[model samples]
Target chain A: MLRALSVIVICGTAAMASSQSNPPNETRSSPATVVPQQQTPTKSTAIIGLDGVKEKTAGTLNVKDGKLCFVHSRNKSQISAAAIADVVTGEDSQRVIRGTLGTLSMFAPYESGRAISMLRSKIDILTIQYRDDDGGLHGVIFTMPVGAAEPIKQELITQGAHTTIQTAAVAARGKQ
Target chain B: MTNFFRITMCSCLFAMLSLAGPHLHAQRKDTEKIKASALKVEMIQSDQIAVPAAFQVAVYENLIQQLGKKASFLHVYRDGDRDAASIPNLVVLHTTVSRFKEGSEEMRQVTTVAGATSITIHCRFTSADGKLLLEKDVNGKVRFFGDNRKATYDFAKRASAVVSDKFSANGQS
Candidate 1:
């Protein structure tokens, strides 16, 4: 009976891990294809340091008229693309479904809740470095749906924003 | 019957050990406290390495946020604030990034073992008169989960732990 229960738990855990292993939207595509303009505004969570919105606020972001704009509720704020100093894209993960269910699952019996809570959903990060009018440096971070960051970055670059890494070959040469 | 009894005994022992783990950890912290008054965090220096601008800002902002939560200082001062100059008992914290490695979040999530981001910082605490108080090489990393920026948060937490273990705002050393 004990061995049977162990096998069941193991299989359940494996299933959960495999199911969320790769987010469906993100794919390993070549850089050239990653740069096409995405017209539709992307839904995102502002993690930290956006000017008007509170931290962790959910919002829609888009590039409009040479600016990157974030809108939450009735309030909106934007930074001109030319003022942006750097655009850095990163990868991250959080507990599945924003962690509320995971938090409640801690009360589950037999320590099985611990395994369930460990499951996570992959996320993409976009960190923007900009300078204000007086030349003071600032940064804002936003987490978006999988596969959303690169296109946004490409759009920003097309609109005159800068990135530290110019190209893959240039980055490799610098490393060497 | 004997085998059942042994298994039950082992389970109880395991339970007892798990319960005692946190209690023992707290006792160790009690012995590591030091006394101080105020702390000023200087801007992070990365002259040796070409850190990304966003990363530099992230590290600086996260450290300031974490230091405010620590009880080790009565006052936390930012870089270039005129107010910190007046605090006679202030200890200045200087941080320089010694090493950094950027890792892919996608690689880590897909493979679970391949991509891990790590950073090493040299932290120095000095008195107003320039005497070194405490210095250590602090490291932060995200091995299996989270963003590359989470490494900055991890570094901040560990550095705060070192400060809490060595300094206190309530009294003099």
Candidate 2:
């Protein structure tokens, strides 16, 4: 009885780990420049906060040519890294979406996908402050899963905006 | 042992989920607070505009509509009200049309289906004491398929952002 139970437990652990996320390949460090027709690109839909404005809008944060692209159903001149002057990971954002996901886990403990991320107790948000062609400063806010934080940080680093973590740890780690 | 592990994980997950309700409620309250302001929109000048007579009026009308619709503040008043300017706190706006170009038939026939239409304007926002708060040369363009006056729409859109972004309700810059 003990041996059969052990086998089941080991299998369950292996299956759970596999289901969480695929192994990070080298492509994560360098996302492809062109999106393939057959493959659907992963995306993060977020509530965008425009600087100097009191209201917020819904948009998707996408990666285009290794630079972040902010697009909505409406709006022109999609914002890209070239427009961004600073990238700040929100240090004190109260992301209610993650909290709401955690609350739902009470009824569905087996919730996977986006819910599992809320277990980390952190709402990972990327607050990008960019300048428009007119030299006006605008702010954009995006909510992303914690799993996507590293790749985004790396991408922004390539564009010259240092993530909060890397900027803080630069002294101890030297050059990255 | 397997059942015990499942029970332990489920219990932990459930407990954390239960605690999130109050936290989420607190966050909702934080974003609701907004500051309001009272602003005055003066006339949109078109003395030097080279466009058609209707085009100028259309552009002027469009700018007023956009500023009223998109900009968020305590109150927005048009210039004709004499009593409004004398109020304790009043911000007056002065605008001058700098440049304008009607849609080009050549570009529409040769390169773009819509051609290019553009407009530029200078704006100054001030307090009742005539103290200048903000001055900026705002412009807009419509190069794609759209109405020629969309250039003004574009200009108004950009100008509204300037107004909403620079000032706040408490009169603090």
TM-score of 2: 0.37
TM-score of chain B of each: 0.77, 0.68
User: Which ranges in model 1 have alpha carbons more than 4 Å from their true place?
Assistant: A1-10, A22-28, A167-176, B1-57, B66-94, B99-119, B124-151, B157-173
Q: What is the Cα-based lDDT of residue B43 in candidate 2?
A: 54
In candidate 2, how many Å is residue A164 off? 60
Candidate 2: regions farther than 4 A off: A1-176, B1-36, B105-110
lDDT of 1 by residue, B60-104 (tens): 767767877864355776666667777877988999999999886
Docking class of 1: incorrect
Model 2, A33-71: lDDT tens digits are 312222123344443334322223445555556466555
> What lDDT does candidate 1 reach at residue B37?
77
Per-residue CA lDDT of model 2 for B39-154, tens digit only, reads 66665677776544334444454555577777765466654545465565677778878887767522442244556877788898887789887788998888853435567668
Which prediction has the highest lDDT against the true structure? Answer: 1
Prediction 1 TM-score vs. true? 0.60
Give a tens-digit lDDT track for model 1, residues A1-176.
Answer: 76577567646875887777765445556444565565578999887767656768998988888899898897888989999888887766676633466556655555555556447677778888777775545678888977788788878877899987554533554589
List lDDT for all candidates, in order. Answer: 0.76, 0.55
Share of native C-alpha contacts between chains A and B (below 8 angstroms) recovered by candidate 2: 0.00
